[model samples]
Target: MKWASDSITAGQITLLRVLFGFLPVLGYALARRALSRHHARHLHHYFAMSLLATSVFYYAFAAGTALLPSGIAGALSGAIPLFTFVCALAFLRSEPVTLLRFLGVLIGFGGVLLIARPWETTHGVDPTGVLFMLLGAASVGASFVYARKFISPLGIAPAALTTYQIGLALLTLMVVTDLDGMTTLADDTRALVGVVIGLGILGTGVAYILYYFIVETLGAVTASSATYIPPVVALAIGWLLVGEPLQLRDGIAVLLILSGVAVLRVTPRSGAAVSPTPRWGPR
Candidate 1:
């Protein structure tokens, strides 16, 4: 997204992401005959999930990644597990909210503040970009809980669930996205390849298939813990590939955020449940 943002509108990037990502997933669904087995009555759930997960998530990500340094943007996204735990506590009755998890949330936000540096008026992370990334993280976080609460109960296969979500997201993007100037991306080889191969196929398509499978097996909050890995990876990529400078705060922030996620994953020994792992399909 950072690579392509300079060449096209965030809306266009988001639209293409869903469009391209949907193709391979759609093909897999056809091969497995997953779509034919989908429950029509649950279409609304799929739409809602797609709206939050893909549409809002990708748009906010594109917009934020355009302004912020890639490392900071990714670190901010590491907060997804925090938001997921909070949402689960509020909405998921079966979700266990232990003191350890609460502490983890606090520790995670501490890292976020280090990244945002709202105290510094100048040279701080862009407030607008931080807000957008946070919105994206929150949307994805909520989607995790929502999926656990609603989608997992349907017993849909992971591939079919991903197909429904991505398919609807593609349709939604088609309605709202403008095609004008989108073709300008053809001139930038790096951006084009990054968007098509990196973001679309690998990031969105393949990632979500594995994600929903994890969600089905491990539960929402646990599945969301996967987000913590991206911050360090992004920081490394930003420095090595994009030549973005890394700061001391970035390393510290990544450490804190990852530690928080680690804490959240450790189940309490006080007999409290960790997270509700729902079996939607055969494991």
Candidate 2:
């Protein structure tokens, strides 16, 4: 959304994040009769997770995209699974450890290494941008782990959780947002509105709905492994449409991410025990 970055600051984008990303979701949740005040009551249990997952996730991402090439940003997203794997292992102790799962985590991280290639300045990627990507990845990673632990145990419906999560995120964004940045949208209302709505509905709303699906069905680590795909797609878009050069390292990074995800997919075969237990009521 940096097309308007010249006019808008990241804080302003974050303020809009509430409207663009979560408001439609809240409306959707209410329309489906999926949310209520009672759900909000237990929301404190999920408050931090939702906050990290959505608000912090998008804020850092807005900064990252503003500063970095879309391809590099995509590659950085690959860090989510790795970060989640570590988070789950350390924080969400319910997930069992196995050789294959460990191997998958390592393999995925190896792919991230090839993509980041911090030693090279060939692409002119901004270091601050890379840091933003990592922070975003870490936020999502920790949130996923927390979801499987604290949120899933509540046995709340995924739709309701989506509503609450996005709702909480909206509230958090409001606290830090700058209303004056709205002046930037005066020039390009369509692109600005479109960016907000598209990202809000598709990226944050629909995306997280699907995300919880994987979190529930597979273990959290497996769910996090999905992170690897977006970077490859981003790289392709950058190369084909945006005219960003995809270096040979980028190509190898894609292959490694594919291989890493393949390894992660194999994890579920031996990882059934680690899957979040799906008993029918809250703990």
Candidate 3:
């Protein structure tokens, strides 16, 4: 979101790139061995591939955001829970589509609309950016579904899966990023440091670890529900750190999204049983 608002210095962008590039690898490595010992090899492979795909898509999404509107980017992100729910219903037998789940989806989307305040924003927001972010959200939802079906069943360690995923992403970025773009890093130490510290450790490393653990324990549908938290987090961060004023709509959106998620949480778990094999896995 911040990246969409203003031009991030080369150092800052690099820091974010590096952190996002490598943190998941550390998390995955921490848990990989344990997971390998417990789950089937194919399952591990699925987890690795899913994580890699997600990481790649995230970079694409972020880079795309640099060209799009922040409001659109945020609105697209808010669709994650709905997409996850749809993916779960279509691909994962363990997650069923109940009325309450549908209601949660409605509430969540409504919250996103409120948070985005698209109506209030001027008409200059790029439609392309909104599509790109939505695509990213869809990719993430698919990843979550796969993780729940394949990774969770295998019970591979979340840290290990995260490590491999991040490592793969880092490798991909190293191969694809323009070397010339990196020269800016030497000119701005503070920005570079901030990017590395904030994005790498906090956003990519720690956040992914928490995400994987949540996915492993709660299943994909429940785990993906956490998507609602980030908007609130971002809003609070902006208000406290940058002196941005909070709006009434933001509060209403939070209430709606949280209420929707709460409704989903209180709903009974699906009675359907899922097979452990990859072929039977969620998408």
The lDDT-based order of candidates, best leading, equals: 1, 2, 3
Residue-level lDDT of model 2, residues 111-227, one tens digit each, is 766766778887587888878988998899898888888777677777788777777777777777867757767688865765677566677777876767677777677777777
Best by TM-score: 1
| TM-score versus the correct structure, for each prediction | 0.95, 0.86, 0.72
RMSD for each model, in Å, please?
1.9, 3.1, 5.7
TM-score of 2: 0.86
Model 1 C-alpha lDDT versus the unseen true structure = 0.87
**lDDT, candidate 1, 222-272, per-residue tens:** 889888688899988898888988999888988898888778877778534
Q: Count the backbone clashes (under 3 Å) in each candidate.
A: 0, 2, 11
Candidate 2, residue 264: Cα displacement in angstroms equals 3.0
lDDT of 1 at 228: 68
Error of 2 at 251 (Å): 1.8
Whole-model alpha-carbon lDDT for candidate 2: 0.73
lDDT of all predictions = 0.87, 0.73, 0.59
Candidate 1 residue pairs in clash (backbone atoms < 3 Å)? none
* Model 2 ranges with Cα > 4 A deviation: 2-6, 121-123, 268-283
Best by lDDT: 1
